[model samples]
Target: MPLAHPFDDDKLKEECGIFGAVGVADAANFVALGLHALQHRGQEAGGIVVHDPVHGFNSARRMGYVRDNFTSHEVMQTLPGNVGIGHVRYSTAGNKGQTAIRDVQPFFGEFSMGGAAIAHNGNITNADALRRELIERGSIFQSSSDSECIIHLMARSMGRTIPDRMEEALRKVEGAFSVVAMTRTKLIGVRDPLGVRPLVLGKFGDGYMLASETCALDIVGAEFIREVEPGEMVVISAKSGVQSHFPFRRRQSRFCIFEHVYFSRPDSILGGRSVYETRENIGRELAKESPVEADLVCPVPDSGTPAAIGFSLQSGIPYAMGIIRNQYMGRTFIEPSEQIRNMGVRLKLNVNRALIRNKRIILVDDSVVRGTTSRKIKDMLLDAGAAEVHFRIASPPTAWPCFYGVDTPQREKLLAATMTEDEMRDHLGVDSLKFISLDGLYRAVGEAEGRDPKAPKYCDACFSGEYPVAPTDMIEKGFQLKAAE
Candidate 1:
């Protein structure tokens, strides 16, 4: 099992990132760099598959970080092709804590049409049902990963071409998916109908690339073309350039709101808005909604920095580096003893004693999941002689587990699920704890009128408890939805 990071365990996790390149020399190298840029999306494992006209399809899937596993010239040499796709993974569906090498993706399948490799970035809501049906119909499963279902479905499709078969297969499956796939000569990218997850198209000279975020494209010096539209699929090849298709029935696009809050790199763009600017706006909105009397507005390190700056600007409070993060610390840092293991948050973060002492500090954070981190940070602040520690979360209370690609604890484990706002503040031992309201968040994300009850602009299921796409597998297992308000 991959060791879970001490701090990462307290927040939601994105499943994976997908990247593909077509018409570039040794495209696998480009894919590797793209995955490295997207390493924040997933760090447990990564895989790359490329097709050379002479060598056919070759793949290297390893269990670790992209730089650790895929950077070697030996591994890069093993995959040679002008077209390829890759994935960096953190298990959300199958074998969650025990991810196997077989579970690592850019999963490959041999077909009558030839061979295709696929890397997926979202959850399949009906995967269990689909897997069972496929198995009963004589499909032998390889990995426990829900993503393998796509390959099996493609095998059963009667369509002539690989893309045709993929289209046929995806129509039968339900839930969020942003898939990057490749055949011998072509690279493909598709986003789910609701645009629940992001996939963008980029151009690099004569070649083209597809990635989970625009930040990846920036790494390889690719020019950002545009986002792959909801329900749209693009097939790219050196010969044909790019072909677009919309196979799924149209619906109001519900892009994941959390991407702006935490998942994506702050440098990336989403919904035509800068993620960093949006987070800053979230802080501004939070300040307006919940004014606080504090001497310093301090961010909970990197993720909260932009929001903290906005909060400081809005409230006329001085922004300070109240807490410092050890940038050298990797997630895989070993704890040699029980004492060291118990010093979890301290391993990653430490309070700036001199700067924050005797100050009324307002700490801005992205979100609170279990409240474990919040409680510990508060204790640390008090111990460092801070007069007050107030938590101002940029996102709303996370009361519901996401059934999309995000890995979240059950409802019972979520702090916001069981406690009210005041209760949470009391439990965390903070002077005050406040989260931006759902409407405030919506407004920050460029929704002028806030979220509409009948029609929301983004998928905020984690905060709102109103899932746009029904979690079929969970519902069948007796998971209940929020009752009418």
Candidate 2:
């Protein structure tokens, strides 16, 4: 069967997911389960590398879902190790084909010190420059991915141990990175200085785990330990247990706000708050900021469901399944071609003609990226005889593209990037449209006082464009940064 695209063809795509475990029997099995929980982060490819005392290191990397590739006993048997790391990848930098397998990670590198396999989440803003420098220094790159730079940097580092070399390597790196690496007997996890991405430490029996989200930990029956702090490197070994090192310079935390908005699983906990509750709060905030009188408050489905519920309660509008989504249809946004993506909305979502006909409907959705899906939904609702369609977005206008880990389109391609609220409503042919204000978004995420102009609570770069980390390579390559509106 041909692979289906992601659920929504218009939202930002998460780059990758990382999971690792040490001191466990069938460590690869546990890692596989953890990756399954994080499948939403990336769906293009999956890989696992395990380190067995007798077998040294064994690996399997395939371009498909974890269940299809790693669930088989045949594939799991090949990776027999007590310590391992795994990755689920989506192509952001590399080519998308069979040749891209070279970039499928849990990327293994053999240094003079030891052999290590690394899985990374988030983009390296300065990767191009680093890659160029590494190439000049006689480092032959095997893949087009920026993540390969980490391995090369570690290889050339003067530090003696793998952890030390990793720290040294990361010091030269600039951008958001949550990395899980396994070296012989040790499993390592590291978060960038700004904490742009998330990595958590979890405990399962006598073993330990490092994963991109708490949801991954839960899949392996691991107890929630604590998050790996920003600028911290956690080295887990049979002998040492868990040891932490602060390798990077100190910086304030700027966790990706989109995690709470759309990326993370609703059941997961982030920053001491439940993602589901946060999204509901976002709906409540939206209702307060942008209220519309309508017969029914409807969600775009799945992503919009929680907020629609909250909006219903807050606005006193009845919630109904005005639009239904096909659970079997994967994310349509991940489809390669524009033509497929253009047709994806119809394939994934259908209007409940009976419920919406001749009624004023409030359409609640998470975020509008290109506006193609929203426009199509509006047309569909009107065709079904809906008298009025009012769009209520749970998040602020997505005016800028995300460069960290999210696969967002360029600014020019974003709907909010070029149009005002009135223009967007007119373009979508909706009766009314309103987005949650930036302050309202902050409020919903538990920031009661709203965003601080000086030091924001979370990374809202996609909405605000005030990137905490400079896009160093882009700047060096003559890409001027646009000022945040």
The model with the greatest TM-score is 1
Report the alpha-carbon TM-score of model 1 versus the true structure.
0.99
- Those runs of model 1 whose alpha carbons end farther than 4 Å from true positions after fitting are 93-96
State the lDDT of candidate 2 residue by residue for 176-287, as single tens digits: 9999998899999999999989999999888999998999999889999999998999999877799987977788899999899889999988988999999999999999
Q: For model 2, state the Cα shift of residue 385 in Å.
A: 1.6
Error of 2 at 88 (Å): 0.7
In candidate 2, the residue pairs with backbone N, CA or C atoms under 3 Å apart (3 or more residues apart, or in different chains) clash, namely 5-330, 5-331, 6-330, 6-331, 6-332, 7-330, 7-331, 9-333
TM values, all candidates: 0.99, 0.96
lDDT tens digits, residues 1-485, model 1? 34667566888889899999999999999999999999999988999999999999999999888998888888899999999999998876345568788889989999998999999999999999999999999999989888999999999999999999999999987889999999999999999899999999999999999999999999999999999999999999998999998999999999999999999999999978899999999999999999889999999988999999999999999999999999977677754477877886898899999999999999999999999988988999999999999899999999999999998988999999999999999999999989999999999999879999899989999999999899999999999999989
Off by over 4 Å in 2: 1-8, 93-99, 331-344
RMSD of 1: 1.0
Task: Give the 10-residue window scoring lowest on summed lDDT in candidate 1.
Answer: 1-10
Model 1 pairs whose backbones collide = none
lDDT of 2: 0.88
